[model samples]
Target: MINTWPKNGRALYTRETVITAIRKTITAVGCVAALTAGAVACGTEQQLSPGKQLSNAFDAMGKQHSLSVEMGLDATPDQLIAMSKGSDEPMPPAMAKAMSKLKVTFSAQSKKALADTEQGDVTGSSMKISGGEGDLVEGRFIGDTVYYRVDLKAFAKMTGSPAPTKEDLDAKLPKGLGFADKILDGEWVKVDTKAMKKAAEKQSKANGGSGVTGGKDGKDGKDGKTPSGKPTLSEQSQKKILEELKGVVNHEVTIKDGGKHDGADHVVATAPFRTVLKSVFDKLRPFADEMSPGGAAKMPKEEDFKEIPDAKVSVDFALKKGKLSAASMDLAPLAEKAKIKGEVPLRMTFDDSADNVTAPANATAIDPEEMIAGAMSLASGARGATGHGGVHGADTSLYTG
Candidate 1:
């Protein structure tokens, strides 16, 4: 996350691992959230109402803050080393040859993040799988461009051929799921647990079955309602979930009744999303196919690697004096193929004391022309410093003879 405060003479560039995980989960299902409004089951149990607490928290998050985050996915050692080496285009031949002798374990980590308020950055890292060995693919964000370094020898060994040049990697990298913006706009909050369960049960009964059976689609057929007469999972269901979840969190806020915090209304807040998230997880276990039901992982035919299972997220918030003060996230277990596993972490904090914390600033709406211009300027500066004359932009290229 980058925060530039001219008045405070402060600039911070930080990557919150936990937040990255949460954002990724959010991104993974954000589209579904948009379709599923008012899908939560917020009971009227007051203190026991996890949904209510979550809603309160979401309400408190009314002021959008600029955020920039980087997530590093671990790839199989061999794959990492191979990918680090460059490639101008798909290297099927090299990949085939490398796969013939490939015996290295592989793992991959992919991150999807929101940035500068509106923009988004999605990055991944992995190790190569060849001869049971790998080289690392290292990268960092320099302005808008992400500069990466891959080992050529590692690539060749993994692919059973000489690795592609730095130019190759640069060309291919951008073509693969580059940073995205506005993919997760509109409203975001936890899925309502009660509503989800209730809906799922209704669908199960409506399906004319004693219990809910797992299938790619929510219901066995396209009649919308299940055979037992319960509503099946649909855009309508999801919308209801978000609405209830939002309300759940909002209820925990400890507003001073009239005071203010961070220039906005000073209502107290709590992150019931943590508890609510777990509930969602339980309810969602049976509906994965329906949530992001389509889209296969894209890859060059020759370099076809096994699919990496999706990651899970757990959110926890810290409340101080009845107000939501901080939030922390925990990631689900990683698949065996993924190098990085276990609880990755993320955090978000609100400092009411911050003098600069005023009315939320303008959303960093994207301007394509301006973005292009900005990229050009940074590229120009990088190229000039490299003394490469007219190499288009920066000489951050990793190459071999």
Candidate 2:
């Protein structure tokens, strides 16, 4: 039998490592969060130029004190299947069918979150992921606490499992699933962000911040100061990003009057989607490499992006009363290779709005140690349950003799 946890129920990893791992997971999740209604980057038009407009609009959007963004995928299952046909190994029919019918949408409401460096700077923030079935997950950050919940019913249905009702948890949690009590009930669970940091600090100081995961010079990340003849990794990375983005922002992206959309001045930004994507990946690689300790971050070479079609993608922005309002993206061009017979639009809409993010009254306080233990237990057995699709006909059975 495999030992899931250290002896006497103690965690093998330090508090800092666990917290860092959690923080990283959350950040990854945030990146995939849906756009307002629809999302994508755009190209050039007119004397002012659409590229400049896109850049300016993006800058303005970032500077907003409060905002709401929502994004939804507007493609049917048949279109999704057609798009997958060109793949070396097309997605499983069952998976594609389920996903196409599944409406995946993301929305975030926030206040004072332009520069997310300090949590305190963000007075309130709420993010949620909902699907055709229902809400799968939700997260809120208010004050010094983080509140989140997982709708097990929605999650199970999305994952191809029989949806479980709250009654299951009301009586008793399933064996080995006690750590997910709040999640099963679709109730809020709160984490004291400051306490988490303090615990990590206490653990670090006890061992002089020289744990197994710490760097050779007794630090977690690079020193704050810039290296000789160079800017800091973050600063260099930001510059690299801006430089690469210029391809779409200053040249490739164009703007055309979309006329009136919902009684607002509509502008559409267009660009060659593939080229923009390639530029973004190319630019982000250096930064990823720099920030990732031991070169953990990796990016595909130019050849790997060959499959992506060179098609123009356009995003529509709606301005109401001379203020930045909402946006939507047209993604049909990108999937031309699939010969899809219908529209594939990803829509976006954002507005200056109040962020009503607040801490939940009956939120369950999660025990980090127990949460980690449960996570490890599930993780160890997950590989066998999953099918590594690259290998054809590979067994995906959860158990094998």
Candidate 3:
């Protein structure tokens, strides 16, 4: 049989992106922990090491709990602007004269994960954003990866109109595709740092960082000019550069302290939240600036991000057998009145084969790209029919594990 998933390509998103999802997944998984934490405290005598407890609790929960979670997303201004620019035909004078409009919403769901090994179900929604309504998108996660669906019509509806199918959607696919896929797969590509280093070095020298004789800090000047006819960095300046470089390169992360979250002690893992976006932009900016009508599209670098300050995930339970019973969980997104609101619902159940089993079969590897494309197409159509806008406004569903 054709593998249900692919095997050899890099995952669509980076570690950080996956981690973000994991953190979000925790909201739903937390419910199981909430109950189990109490049981765990009662079962253990000497204070358990926070880190060990985290490992142990998750282990237990994984064996016994499964949860259902959902989330909502709101589009950034850039996405809305891009959407409004899409059209089925070249704008006529009258239509061209009218300003384009757009808006958006986003969200997702996952069946039981962190709570238990018994597989569970998760479903959620998304929509195309515009001034009126948004498109709809949704998903289900059974094992290691998620299966998502999206509605494009709802996206079109956000602008107070029906979204065109096929052709019109295809026209807008190129630019919107990447963002859509990234959102669906919840990942971004890694950058080639080696290339970035070369670019950075060339740019630095071009900006007058070459050393020469009789320079302000180095060798004698030739014809009253440095070898590259540019000024070099002073020893202090270079030292400062080196110091700053050390901070970002090859930094190590370790958990040194344990803290309380949701009324229980847990280990804290810390690391730099770097991304490939920085390096990609760094290498391309020069070329983009030198050519093209777009005038070097301004892309945000990873460093431009501000730390979220309090993002965290906690382990409350561990199910050793991967057969969750009496497991309970409620991710905030899933708690919305539109979804399941009372007494955390039993969302999914998994077979023992999926529990604590590392290494999902390489043969069944998921194609994040395919998953994204399928989801966007589905979202486009769903939006058109429902007049919804984006994932945030889409309907939620329960599924079998």
Candidate 4:
């Protein structure tokens, strides 16, 4: 139904955002490679340099009709806690005990071609946060809607909060009556992005906002401006980003042959931890400045990142029968800044996912305004309950997939 996973929206810090960062990083590398892929003298795939091979593999995955990516944490909860905390000192006993109960595995299936990242493109993805008994939370993105639900008791246990009883829902659902029990059962909820967009546009207009409202035509605008007036990355911005990232990709990121993994040919892409981040930031500063003329980029200074040592961050891409099958990255380097030392591996596997990413049937759709109304009703002692079937958005950020 509606995406109500703990708003952090990830099982591990590594699953979505980290993988997104990795994808963006690698996509920049592939962009630069695409520029040269045609011009370079053709050669056998085996003869290509590590960087070129990686670029080609990344490109090949992008060219697929549709793809799926599965990412998971291979470390124990204790290790995850240490890496997450980034502290040299031991975690408080209570905190460690509580965190250790979590399940860090997550999977996502998507229908978009990797390189077809243009705005307004219709892509679908589904994610599940695995738990010992079942999924703690899950969500699916189908076109302009997202469906999500959480196991109330499991989520409550994970967060160390009391599970919302049907009574809790009844308290807010004076008009809806005994409907809270069914909702608390974790029925799917969907949020219509189109509706959200319309509401946002109306609210923006009411507030005297001048930005273009995004829809079919306004998704991508001139000068990297989106409908919200926020800078949407343009091809040129990507080019600038690629220019900054190309050097490290070529010189620092190395690819080596790993004989076999999961019955597939594996290729490793390695780079220095601090080197890539610094270079990425350094090159991005000018373009970030260009976006909002005269304002300094809010990116961190070099000195601010001194905690991260120049450790190697290796990403392994797997090819099965010459097709991209899976990929994984070691996340230990990121945790080193926290004074934690150990391997924190996150693996992502790919597949054909077009037929699999369908929207769920019978999802209860709720608008954001209804959510606001519901919240106000709760605060006002539920006397002013709306006539609608009330289901407020769930704040399930502790484990988002």
What C-alpha lDDT values do all the predictions have?
Answer: 0.34, 0.52, 0.33, 0.54
Residue 91, model 1: lDDT of 26
Better of 1 and 2 by TM-score: 2
TM-score of each: 0.28, 0.67, 0.25, 0.66
Top candidate by lDDT: 4
Candidate 2 Cα outliers beyond 4 Å, as residue runs: 1-63, 88-118, 158-160, 163-177, 193-231, 234-244, 247-251, 284-296, 384-401
Q: Residues 204-276, candidate 2, lDDT per residue (tens digit)?
A: 5475554334444544534332112222367656765665665435555556667775788776766665666
Worst 10 residues of 2 by lDDT: 29-38
Q: Write the per-residue lDDT of candidate 3 for residues 1-401, one digit (tens) a residue.
A: 00011133211222122224335434434423432333333333333354355446445545432232222223233322332233222222222112122222232233554443222343322222223323233333333333333443433233223333343334334344444433333232222333434444454456575432234554434443333223334566555544433333223222323444444343433322222223324444544423322335555445554322222222222223222222222222232222222332222222333222122122223334443444455555445423443233322101000
The better candidate by lDDT, 1 or 4, is 4
Highest-scoring model, TM-score:
2
Worst lDDT window (10 residues) for model 4?
Answer: 382-391
Predicted candidate 1 versus true structure: per-residue lDDT over 1-401, tens digit per residue? 11111234332211122233335544433322221222222334443344344445444433333222222332233442343234332224334234324332222222322222322322322222223344323333322333333343554344333333434333323332222121112111122334444555555557574434333444443543222223346987577656555564344222112244444332222223334344444444444444543211211222222232333333344444444554444322322233443443333454433222111223333334333333444345434534562234433322211
The Cα RMSD of model 2 versus the native structure comes to 9.5
Better of 1 and 4 by TM-score: 4
Give candidate 1's whole-model lDDT.
0.34
Task: Quote model 2's TM-score.
Answer: 0.67
> How well does candidate 4 match the true structure in TM-score terms?
0.66
